[model samples]
Target: MLAVSRSVTRARIAARLPIVERTTAGRPTPTRTTKERTMPQHPKGSVLEFDLRGTGSGVLQEVAIAGSEHAVRAEGHPAFGGTDSAPSPLDLVLSAYVSCNQVTATIVALGQGITLGAFEGRVQAELDNSVLVFGAEGDGTFQRLTLTVDLETELDDAAFDAFVAEVARRCPLTQLFERAGVEITNAWTNRALARV
Candidate 1:
């Protein structure tokens, strides 16, 4: 089970917002009867935890959130002589960066009063494994990270650029990459011709 240390009650969170349901046509429609929604309010400065135990040997491990029963397996890269049964830790980190960008960018855009229509993205990272695997002196970090996003919105070109700039500034993963001196690139596509 995943144990989240909630400083606020669930009722308080539920009281803050009405339940919204997606219709068959994929439009968000508010329901007449409000329901207690999971993750209704975002908790700030919350301490998150993850617990993991080695499954057997060979650098394979099973991980679980403290209050959650679900677990996932992780393993070392096959290039390091271990069976590639699951994603490596580095792979997970890369995935986290990608997922974080998507979530943060969308939330920020919505907060900026931009009605989001559709959003899709792809992330790619280039890494040099020689440092970690071959005992090289240099860093074993990502040399470059790139994000390509297709956004369906009515914002004009200037407004779209501004939105993307704000997203890049606000995204934690983007800042992390910047702080770590990693080269990051972003490409965006507007799906709608109408301007706002």
Candidate 2:
């Protein structure tokens, strides 16, 4: 049942966007017509800035925001010559993407007068290690990413679709990946909200 939902979501996304062709490096190269090449608009004074500081040596770092009581420890993977202590930079990036989507979804649901239950997200990425590890001539970004989200909601099929679409449009992290030319697919599963 979940697999069928994912298939439908993928089909919907593919049908709405312009056709994309795969490059020799297995990355997607999107093709758009003149009519479809409009840029997104940002209203005045809408920009938000964030700042953080980190200190580390030998592929391990402790990062924290100013005036915050919490700090995050990050380390490089063992393959990159660092002790496998904490999440690597790439892992943090994927974590940001998932958390950003959930936050955006909560805001969207609130605005739409909807209530949400338990939510979970998973991200799978294909990284081209050749560029990072070896002196490769290609881009080092993830070749592809798949984000699957499971949410318990009471909305119907059409409402769920609209909610998901709106969340995608408003998610800053999603915009970052799309603008960077990363091939990303989002599969959302809307489960029935359990009543207690």
TM-score of each: 0.68, 0.75
Model 2 spans > 4 angstroms off? 1-46
| Clash pairs detected, candidate 2 | none
**What digit string (tens of lDDT, one per residue) describes model 2 on residues 1-196?**
1111222332353344333332437664443345645443643222222446799998999998644566888898778987788999888999999999997887677656777887899999998889999979988888898999999898999999999999999899999998888999999999998777
What lDDT does each candidate get? Answer: 0.69, 0.78
lDDT of 1 at 194: 33
Global fold similarity of model 1 (TM-score): 0.68
Q: Deviation in angstroms for 62 in model 2?
A: 1.1
After TM-score superposition, the amount by which residue 119's alpha carbon in candidate 1 deviates from its true location, in angstroms, is 2.0
Model 1 C-alpha lDDT per residue in residues 56-168, reported as the tens digit of each score:
56678787643345676778878776578789877887787877776665666546656566567788888898998888998778899988988776689998888888888
List the pairs of residues colliding in candidate 1. 1-67, 1-68, 2-67, 2-68, 3-67
Error of 2 at 31 (Å): 39
